[model samples]
Target: MDYLDLKYTPKEDIVCTFILKGKEDKKTLSSKIAGESSTGTWTKVLYSKKELNAKVFSINKDTIKIAYPLELFEKGNIPQLLSSVAGNIFGMRGIDKLILRDIDFPKKYVEAFKGPELGISEIRKKTGIKERPIVGTIFKPKLGMSPKQMAENAYLVFSAGLDFAKDDENLSNQDFCKFKERFNLITKVLDKVENERGRRPIYAINITAPYDEMVKRAEFAKENNGNCIMVDAITLGFSSLQSLLSKKWGMLIHCHRAMHGAITRSRDFGISMLVFAKLLRLTGVTELHTGTVVGKMEGSKEEVVEINNFLRKEWFNIKPIFPTASGGLHPVLMPELIKILGKDLMITSGGGIWGHEMGAASGAKAMLQAVDAGVKNIPINEYARTHKELESAIKSWKGFEKENYNYKIKH
Candidate 1:
């Protein structure tokens, strides 16, 4: 069977690039990958259909591009599409490593699903925050807290000048924190805070659970005037996200990459974070968690920048998804973060804010102060001279620079 067809470019085709590793030559491995992922098997069948095969149209060293036919996938079905393109081929024998580098979803696929309901611009409009990274803090002590406890913590963060506060990825409708109870209490707190601050605040309640239960929670949240809904996009699956997006809940969908490291960490195996981000964007995620280059995550400045750019760039009229720089972030790192990622971002801190010397309120104040400094192009240390919150945060948290960790950028 021939798996390389260079002349054909079909609108209904999905193009994917992968980093192949094995003893076999690039062409041989590419053919095996194309075949296994599409419609071929170990042994040649009696009948061969040309349209059923995935064609490897391009290859450059370890990177191979295979285009799968549109007829091979069901319309608007992400699960089926991934099953065909990102499925069983990874486990192929003798292939020491297989990394799916990226995917080019054809216009037909992009048009099939409703993208972000509240995209970057709309979200900024809602928050009335323009020309700065939307600052946010995660409700710390991720779990084992009651609805009242969580709402109180959220109130402190919101009132102290943060734009958003979210339930941790692990906290859903647990026994201690029932989703409805938690969401209602948090909504009331947000309302009170909004009146005091005279600005809208977003609270991304974790609506990740069984599909039906998740939908129920979403509806309940909407009825109670919740502004956003979060889902562990990688764990709950893209199809589930599509299900949520299809409803047009008029709420920002925060796509959390909770279990993505399992498939994205390896330099030589699994799929790249870029691929996941593209797919999630295509599937209508409003705010996606792209890692902070300076944070605890493994991604480098270049890699995270590339992902963020891709998410924000225009893709056939689909709205831009907001890139969130989170994980181990602090007030002290705000300027460097702005220097690297620019103003279009949601800078979130978990331990960075919660572990502050004063408390969550002061921590939230410090984050806003740092963002103010970053926006005005003022040096953090210089700005901290007069700002007590900023000074306190700087004195307490060493920030990402002190870690002294760096990665080599490959050509």
Candidate 2:
């Protein structure tokens, strides 16, 4: 009776065909989309007292099959309702999908997952960033650092008072940093932070590698230590992520879509990240990258918020996942980022942090300062008067001055 174990698929325009089970001695139900026998054979019936149309119905034993108009279950409400009811008894093991035309979206079921576990409030409580997106940076670009070096940087990143840092997507073994060695080293650094800071800065070590190697690493990391596991899912593929996320772990599933834009970014596009966002959650990615609005990738503010909503929206009882906004980001953009993304997000800067005049650690500190400015709704440069890191960074590029809107796509 654990509804979380089975989520119903009322995908757009598709008829969900579920093989009825139990109390029945062997039941056969025919299809009806909005009460008309769109197909060859079906026994029809009315549901709930709606007379204009035969909305929904049920079957009994092997002799009875009742079909209803698809409109009664409009807005995907019918499907979710069906799943909720069916899953409570039948489970989602074998349900077939049917397509619906002129289908209306279920407004009632729209914010179905509207609740939050560690929503913006809880994420803030956990990381201590009250207003702006939490600062995150990855120690990856080319991905050729030794485990010791990676661990060393992890220690410095935590020591500098920044919130979180992670291993780049491609940081697996290649005559350089092996996954085990790096995970082991960084995990040790996490323990150090835990003992000192009372709460350790999360380290999302890359678990993305060849299939066998990747699972091997994920299993190892889950069993051993680390705050979370990072995966370049586009490279690993959709199903692959599901496989890895199946294992238990305390850390969040940190995702870096190294090649996602190839399919999602086109105007007349292949598919929407919105679609992928739903699928990603089904597959269990707790944190996903939606690119930054004003950063290098050119995603619009609307696009950014839309994707963020998809990630955080309560889908079943699943823990709310955080959206990571990166791409050519720096600390200065935090205010605009927060205004659009709300608070359940993680903002990461790379060269913007690594190349800071004060140093990588200070750059991170500056990013945190930028977030504080956003939460407090103060000017970044003005915040600089007090926070040294913010002041130094503002003296240079002044990342806070840029427009927070998406740039027009040139192509």
Candidate 3:
């Protein structure tokens, strides 16, 4: 039953760091966490193996680090890994709050899973956008748009020079906009735009449904010349995301964290977005919605930066995921977002593009102009003076104010 081991180095183990708060003392709660997550039970079993038990190697204040043996987790199974490290322990006795802060996977474990089929660089090459953050927009009026209307809207933005367009996380095979019809229409629009502009823009069609349905939709997209597919990663579950990635459809996988707030919003309990980002990267999502620091999202600058860094950094042979900064973002906020997140990002806006004073095309132009100004180190207002779209957007949105950044807009 004794799981504490200050001397353990954890060479080949899956090490997890957790912040736990409970009625029991730190040592007792930490041991309980180690025991419940790996081996050992409430009362000592008739048999036990010391090697299989997770060891609490480091404990600092309310934070504890538990190293689990590699054998305890299946090689490429994300669900099994979460079941061991992030399971049962949450509802255990004497625990009031628990947050899974981070996890360090051994090389052997990391290599077992298939990473991104097309990483950041490959995507850039395919999209023909060598520099500047990739610009995109979520289909506004997130619901109620028919397949033809959706395709027309996509054409407006793609022809206006945006790098990509996607379905909002909630949009799926609704009765009004069936998945196959939507995909067919949008791909045709993208093809037309590509022929005219000489650069194929990405269309991340949302294919989040049951496993078999999702696979069918993905195959449909692949056959119809779709370049990207979007999934509600959190809602669909990591196991489904991994399965989709393993298919190697040669389409970019865009991960939308739709229900992440339920699990990650609380600072005191549940899991951190950093952990989610790592698992998503390991599961091989080409792009993931991290957060927009100066936008309507809840994540701070430091936390978002850390999560984005982990997604893009080198992790054994796993391909780096493109960090997407979205939610309540717009033309005026582009400079600040680019400054904080750098060029290796996907700048996604919803109402920001659709709510423009002129129209969606003008709105799309404004977003691109703002990104151009930010990338060139030009002041947005000064740049807007020469660009009517940016000027209209600044006036329409009342410009970007750091003090009023978090004000919610109807997205």
RMSD of each: 3.8, 11.5, 1.7
lDDT of 3 by residue, 1-411 (tens): 379998888889999999999998888889999999988788867778887889999989988999999999889999998898889988887888899999999999999977889898998889888889999999999899999999999999999999989999889999999988898898889889989999889999999999999999999989888889999999999788888778879899999999999999997779999999998888888999999998878898999999999888898999887999988888998888899999999989988899998999999999999999999999999999999999999987764444565555633
Q: How accurate is candidate 1 locally (lDDT)?
A: 0.85
Q: TM-scores of all models?
A: 0.94, 0.69, 0.97
Residues 39-75 of candidate 1 have per-residue lDDT tens digits of 8989888877877899988878777789988778887
Using lDDT as the measure, what is the rank order of every candidate, best first? Answer: 3, 1, 2
lDDT against the true structure, each candidate? 0.85, 0.61, 0.90
Candidate achieving the largest TM-score: 3
Off by over 4 Å in 1: 6-12, 399-411
Count the clashes in each prediction.
Answer: 0, 16, 0
The candidate with the higher TM-score, 1 or 2, is 1
Question: Which scores greater on TM-score, model 2 or model 3?
Answer: 3
Judged by lDDT, which candidate is best?
A: 3
